[model samples]
Target chain A: MTEVLSGLPAALGVESLLAMLAGTLAGIAVGAIPGLTATLAMALLLPFTYTMDPLQSLGMMAGIYNGAMYGGAIPAILARIPGTPSAVATVFDGFPLAQSGRAKFALHVALVSSAAGSFLSAVALMLLAPPLVEFALQFGPAEYFWVAVFGLTSVSLLLAGAPAKGLASALIGIAIGLVGMDMITGAERLVFGVRHVAGGIDLAVLLTGLFAVPPALAMLSATGKHAEGLGMTGPGIKVRQALGFARTWLRSGLIGVTVGVMPGAGGNFAGILGYSEEKRAARDDSMFGKGDPRGVAASECANNADNASSLIPTLALGVPGNSVAALMMGAMLIQGLNPGPALFSQHGDVVYGFMWQMLFTALLMLTLGFAGAKVFVHMLRIPSALLAPMILVVCLLGTYASTNSLGDIWLMLAFGGLAFMLSRAGYPIAPIVLGAILGPMAESSFRQALLISQGDPLRFVSSPISVVLVIAIVTVATLPLGRILWRRLRARDARRAEHPPPLRKDR
Target chain B: MSTPPYHGAQVGAGERLLVHAAVAALGGAVLWDSFSQQGASAYFPTAIGCGLILLSAVSALKVVPRRLLTSEATLVKGLGGLALLAVFALLAGEAGFLSTALLFIPAMALLGGDRNVPRVALATVSFVALAYVVFHVVFAQSFPPEFILGGR
Candidate 1:
């Protein structure tokens, strides 16, 4: 702890701190806009970091990750549109809360949860990285595959209206994930010989399309004379009730850290899982589908929790947990720092500086989210007519900036159209994005596990870790059916008690 | 998740039937496509496709058609907006982001039914200026070829 804190003063030096602040504010702006994403924000900034001291660059990227994760909730609350893919579930409750003019309270809850999640995860990274990474390293490919499936099943069962539609949407995402060159055979599987297929479909492009495009279209769907403003005012519950805060934050934060430490599972899974669980556990679940503060807290906290723990596998095992961590790993390499066990011995100061940076960045997100709440609430004043177009412009530009590729722009539009369709049919889009993110990881891991076992099917169940993961997945997947059956049995008992089954005319 | 207020083209009975059939057909296509591939690549997608087919058939039979229908007007307008975006993509690379955005913003506002000239004008000018400061000034990056200024 002392070592980490000692390194923090150096990062607090003027230039590095300014870089962090500037990066975070820019990230907030990018994230508040529909179609832009944290990954795209990080990718765009990666080049700029080449010129800075590695510590300074790492701090800025860390700030951006936390900043953007919180920023996405703004539009999710205001426009029923997710500014980032991770914010997709945030819209479930956040926007509904906003619709009834509780936007400020929801935003406040999101900010608080994001900070709590990030801070705790940062602390975990500081104190427990070695042991946690050691445990995480036990996960073989089979385990990784099962872990993703478990995450996917939990969220799928929690889908509100139609489970089959959720599954179909997930299949669409996996199909999209199958595009581009085969990682194993080096042959084209789905791409129709297009030059762009080799690079594959960019997640940012798909996310921007799936999330950003639909809301703008929804605005145009309105035929009425345009309203001058959103009619929003006042903060809705600035501070959450004490009990709700503790339970929601703890549950979601744990889910976030657990999922974040796993390589390739990513924060969206954590956010979705958190949201689904909170939705399930809420006493007044009618509010769960409506605007519930717990929803924002769960998803926001869980996503930000990934901010710190996602670095665990990256720093300790030399395996990037997700793409943002991949960029951070790239920065480490640029600084002539190698990850893995030797990294601790060789660059303890720099690693601790990174941890302190995560802690400080979470604090910054809280401060900024607090001060900026009222100002951002003013975004509702932008006329509905003009607001939609402005968002459209931002989305198009952000998607283009994500990669200099025009094909990505095309993919964004196509997915945007797809989002419009799926959403109309009342299908949830979160599962689709989750499936896309997890699809490659699951498939590659499954295949690789099989290959390692020389095509032995039993090998998947042989390892203890894999066995536990398989059991977890099966149990979680069957839980909804079990609950349904249990409810039916109770209902039958209630009915029998009410009628005595019978004043049965025969009796 | 709560559904967005996205009214797209309403699916009539005939169209709904066709749409469901089309979904099944697409699944079949994926299934057939996966079957042709050898070894590992075939497995995941084939499972997904076959599942999609079964799900689609079951959804068509069990779920009401009303759940599948979206608003026609919204659908047409949204797809139309996408066409406008495609135009921006085609032009932005050559014309410069500032110039392309200036044209694109007002055009979309109009498409979205905004006729307030002052508001449209204000948005165009402000967005351009903001993009200038954010992209060109602070980042010191090039969003170059100011169409009005000619590759500045």
Candidate 2:
């Protein structure tokens, strides 16, 4: 505690403070735009940090990390577009709430939830890094495969009303995810002679197409119709009302931090898991996908919560949990600070100072994001016709800027068209995104586990963690079925009560 | 899972069955392709193919048709919007982002039923300027070479 406290002065240094504020501002801008990922922004900013003092550089990174995670919720709420992959779950409830004229309320929920999650996650990292790192290390190849499967199944099965459509959407995504070079064999599996596709579909392209384009198309289709209420005005939800969601914040924060500590599982998975759990826990989940504030809180809180906890592994064991953490590790190496336990012994102050930066930057984000929400809610005031075209422009420009590949833009358009058709068929598209994101992880881990076990199928259950994960996957996959059976039984009882089952005649 | 049909649309069971059947066929084709493959990489796809087929069959049995949410007019508009996007993408490659965006915005706005030409033109200019400032000026992103304006 004393050693950690010693870092506060450096964290509060003028340079560090300025860097944090600037980085946070830049991060918010980067994250609010489609296709400009926090990962890309941080990567671009990494070089500029090399010559700065370690605390200052680290503080900037901390600010960007927290800021981007929260900023992602903005576009997701006002439009149906997710500014970042982690914000996808936020769209489930955020967009609906906005359409109901509760844009301000939804934004407030997201802001508070994000801040609370990030703050608690930073605290968890400070106090629980060692144990979390150890726990993360327990996930073997089999466990990782099951974890991916668990995330995919839980979200797909519960996100929509029809389990069949949900699962099928995910299956479609997996198939699309398979349309590239196979990592294990180094051979093109489903490229079908397309050279551009041999590199595999970019996640950004798919995300932009699936999330942003469909909405734009919908707005165009509804152009001449009675102007759909964009919910530019509504009753204000008090900050205290947002605070009343403490239970959801804590639950989702725990899920986020847990997933964050696991290597390769980032905020996207955490957000999905948090949303699924929130929906599952709700007694009346009919409003879940339609715009429940709890859903936004769950998703935003979980994703932001992971921001700091994701560093636990990188700090304790030198294994970066995600790309941003890997970049942060690179920053430390550039500063001649080696990672791992010995680094703590050598530079306890800088290490703890960075954690402090994470906590303080999250607080800064809360203020900025709360104020920014007031401005962002005006996005709904634009006519849907003009707004639709503008959204398409942003999506187009963003996708094009990411890789400078026109082929990606074409692919995005194709996905958008197909997505619009599937959505018309009543298939929820969120699972497709979830599936694509998790598919590669699942496949790679599945192969690795098989290789390690020498092709023994039973090896999936060889470890306790894998066994638990397998059980979780089964339970999650069967949850919809269980719900259906329960509903049928209840209906049957109701029918019997209504007519006395004609058995009363026999009686 | 017990929520009402999506969008409150009434779906015909036969239509749903047809959709499921189509999905099943697609899954079957994938399974067949995976079988022809000659490596460990095929295993995952093969498993997915089977799961998709099985799920489609199960879904086929419980078809509840919802409303025809997308009218013919809406479908036409949706297709038109896609065509507009495609044209914009292709044109940008040749005319550069700035020139193409200038044309694309007004065209898309018109297609979206914006009949006010001056307002559309104003929106077009403002949006293009904002895009230039954000993407080109701030991020320093490179756009394709233009026959008109010099490329960034």
Candidate 3:
């Protein structure tokens, strides 16, 4: 407690606080844009932090992390396009609220919930991180290998609807990860004599291309079709309304934080679960699909809270909780910080500074989001024709800036084309990105563990941590499948009962 | 929801088979390369390749399967856009930033179904000029010189 209190002053210096505010503002702007995410914003700003104090640097990044999560809600609410994948589930009710002349109320709900969610998660992180780190310290290479495999399996199985497609995407991602020099043998696997390929694909560049550019291109392709109607502009909800929403959706916020801490369960899942739970709990359930402030509040709060708590596992265990968190971990690595228990011990000041900054950043997000509500809503008025071109330019510039290589631009175009097709065919893009991100790490760790154990398969089960991870992985993967099967069976039974099936047809 | 009429259009079973065969061949190549590597390198890629092949086969086997070739117009547009992108990449090393971007952006936009060719061309030119000023002049970043037109 003394150590924590003593560290607070250095962490909360005026300069650091100011930086955090600025970063939060910038993160919100970047994240509100359809193609930009928190990870991209962090990666872009990382180079600028090279010369700053570690605490100040982390302050800015932390602010971005919290603010971007909130920023994603902007596009989700207005355009039915989620600015970040975490906001994907928000669009279900958020856009409908906007369409029903409750845009201001929706924005208010999102902003308030986001702030509340971040606050809750920041508290959780501060309270739980040390113990989590202590527990994480017991992991070995075999354990890490299993953890990575488990993360990949759970993410692929649950997140992507088609198991086969998800596995394929994961495999492709691993293949991409194999593009650079081999870690153990020092052999170039698939460089094809290209020096840039030898360095391997940057996760930042891959993400910018895979997630950002393709969607922008897709938008451009469909730009001729205009978005109909105007978003609402009014005084929004009164204090009493907002407070009522907060009181009603408090449990959803808790669920969000809990789900966020769980590996592989992301904001999308949290938002859906929260929305359903809130609807079920509502005294008047019919108000849910309408412009219900509580409905939006529940989803927005859970998603944002989930986003913050998702970082807990990544920071403590060095195992990313989701794709966005994985990208954050990648950014940390790019900044020369090794994630895990050592990160907390070696960079306690920086890590704690980040925790403190997140609280202030959440406050800043609330202020800016509420104050600038009109400005953000007005962004929806821009014609898709003009917006599409600008998005393309940003995508090109972002891709180029990451590597300064035109090759990356070509790679982006190719992937963009492939992604556009996949999306059109009803295959989800998120799992592919997750697979790509987790693929190499899992493969390398698995191989290393096997080699260390002289190719013994039982080595994984021998370790307590690995056994626990395997069990967790199995439970996560199987539970979802079981639930899905049960739902199908129930649906079949319902149809049979309703139709009185075969007897009538035979008669 | 009723299936769209475009769903049952001209892609036949043979073409679908060919596409899956091509994907399988790609997987095979990857698998062969993976096996050539030392230690467990083979396992990862081989697993991935096999999975890809399996998925591609499953997809191919579905009746009225989702084929790569959707419509003649869409196919032409996609191929044309891909070809233009390839040309742009090839020309990037030789053409100056302004010339390449001015030509490429409008062409790609046009292929993307924008009918206002002249407006797209103008916008592309304006954007390229702005980009050049920002990146080369203001930002002091070096770019490829106009080799085709000699010096700039």
Candidate 4:
């Protein structure tokens, strides 16, 4: 602990501080822009960091990592579009809050929750890196498969009223994810010989099409007179109301840190799981998908909490948990610093400084977010007609810029159209995204586990972690049925109470 | 009478049935494709296909009251907006992002009933410039060349 504090002085240096601020600001911008991602921004910055001192480069990357996670919520709250994939869960309640004229309040909740989560994650990363990395290493292929399955089942709550449609949507996503070359056999499985089919559908393109375009279409559907700025000047949430969500923040923070430490999972998965778990734990989940602040708190908190903890595996065991962590590892390698225990022993000051930078950057993000939010909320003031087109333009430009592929743009439009139809048909969209993200993870791990066990189906439950995950999956999968059975029993009891003939029926 | 229980979309039983049928057909198609594949590659698709079929069947058996997902007027307008987006995508490569966006913004604004042409034009120009600065200059990302603007 003292060693960690000793590094703080170096992290607080002027150059390092400036770099951190710049990265955080850039991260927020990139994250807030539809189709632009923190991974892309970090990848772009990786080369330039080669010449800088290790602390400066690491500080900057940490700032961006935390900042982008929070920045994604801005678009999610003000517009229905999630700026980053992790912010997808935030859209469940944040956008509704915006629609109900609580945009400021939602943004504030997201910002605070994000800071709280990131701080907790950074603290966990500092204190528990070795142990968490050891626990993460315990996950074998079978366990990873079960983890993916658990992730899929946990978010079933998002399906809520339309379980069947939601399940179908998830299946559809899995099917889409199945398109292109088979990862294991290198065979063309589902390609219909379309151009770029071999490369598979990009998740970014899918997300942009599914989440961003539909809102624009909805805007065009409305009449000229908008909802008078969607309550732009409405009262913000009170501190007391915000404090009510502290428990949610803490729980989501734990979920995020745990997921982050595990390989093959990322912030998006953590955020969704946190939101679902929050809904499940709530006494009344009726307001969950309808602009509940707890939903925003859980989602934002979990995603930001994922930021620093994701690097625990990378720094401790040289295993990058996610793409952002992989890039950070690359940055470290470029600085001639190899990750693992040797890194701590050899470069204690720099590594611990990096950890300090993560904590400080999170605090910096909270301040900057609040300052910028006042300006961002004015997005509501734009006439819906203009706002709609502007969003369309941003989506089009952002999609095109992502890969410079015209086909991807066309593909996005197709997904957008499909999403528009599915949403109108009353399907939950989040599960589809979840399915697409988890399908490949689940399938590959399942296949690997099978190969390892010589095709034994029981291999899935051979490990303790796998057994726990399997139980969790079964419980989550049956939650809807449990609710249905409970409802029926309650209704029957109500009926018996209504008519005293029920007493005679007992005889 | 008390309100009918509804979750997301409120549509006629026929529409719901049609959607379920479509889902079932999609599942069948996927299942059929999986039969020709080999090894672990086929396992996931097969599972997803079967799940889809079963879920759609169960959903078809459930009773739900009929309601409108959106008003007819709004539906027409929304479809129009989608059509415009399709047109924009097709033309973007040929006309370039700037030229295409220049035309798309005004068309979409007008379609959305924004009759203020000057305001629309200003917004269009400003957005184009901002995009150019951010995407082209800061990011150095390349876009399709504009024949209309001398290969911008």
- Predicted candidate 3 versus true structure: per-residue lDDT over B1-152, tens digit per residue: 11111221244555546655655665676677777688676677778777778876765565364444332224344446556656765776677545666666766665555667677766776777777676667765555575533275
Local error of candidate 4 at residue A463 (angstroms): 2.3
Candidate 2 regions off by >4 Å?
A1-118, A121-130, A222-362, A369-374, A502-507, B1-22, B65-73
Q: Looking at every candidate separately, what fraction of the true A–B Cα contacts under 8 Å does it contain? A: 0.40, 0.47, 0.15, 0.57
Q: For candidate 1, what is the recovered fraction of reference interface contacts?
A: 0.40
Candidate 3, which segments miss by more than 4 Å at Cα? A1-103, A192-195, A223-232, A238-240, A421-428, A477-484, A499-507, B1-23, B62-84, B96-99, B103-142, B145-151
Residue-level lDDT of model 2, residues A1-507, one tens digit each, is 776788789899899899888878767765665444576566445544445789988888888888888777877887676767799999899988988888778877888899999998999988886554456567777876876677667656765568888889888888887887788777776676789988888766776677667766666644432222244347656867976899999999999999887654679889999999999998999999898899999999999999999888678755454556756775686688866666777898899889899999988887777666555444333455666777777777767776678998899898888777667666777667657656776788888988998999999898888888788778877878799899999999999888784444554
Clashing pairs in 3: none
Q: For residues B112-149, write the lDDT of model 2, one tens digit per residue.
A: 67787887788888887887776677767777875445
Per-model interface RMSD values are 5.5, 7.1, 6.0, 7.0
Rate residue A156 of model 2 by lDDT. Answer: 69
* Top DockQ hit: 1
Q: List DockQ for all candidates.
A: 0.37, 0.33, 0.22, 0.36
**Lowest summed lDDT window (length 10), candidate 2 chain A:** A223-232
lDDT of 4 by residue, A38-88 (tens): 775665465446457898888888888898898888777776767678999
* CAPRI classification of candidate 3: incorrect
Give the best candidate by TM-score.
Answer: 3
For model 1, which pairs clash? Answer: B7-B71, B8-B70, B8-B71, B8-B72, B8-B75, B9-B71, B9-B72, B10-B72
- Candidate 2 Cα RMSD (Å): 8.4
List the lowest-lDDT window of 10 residues for candidate 1 chain B. B1-10
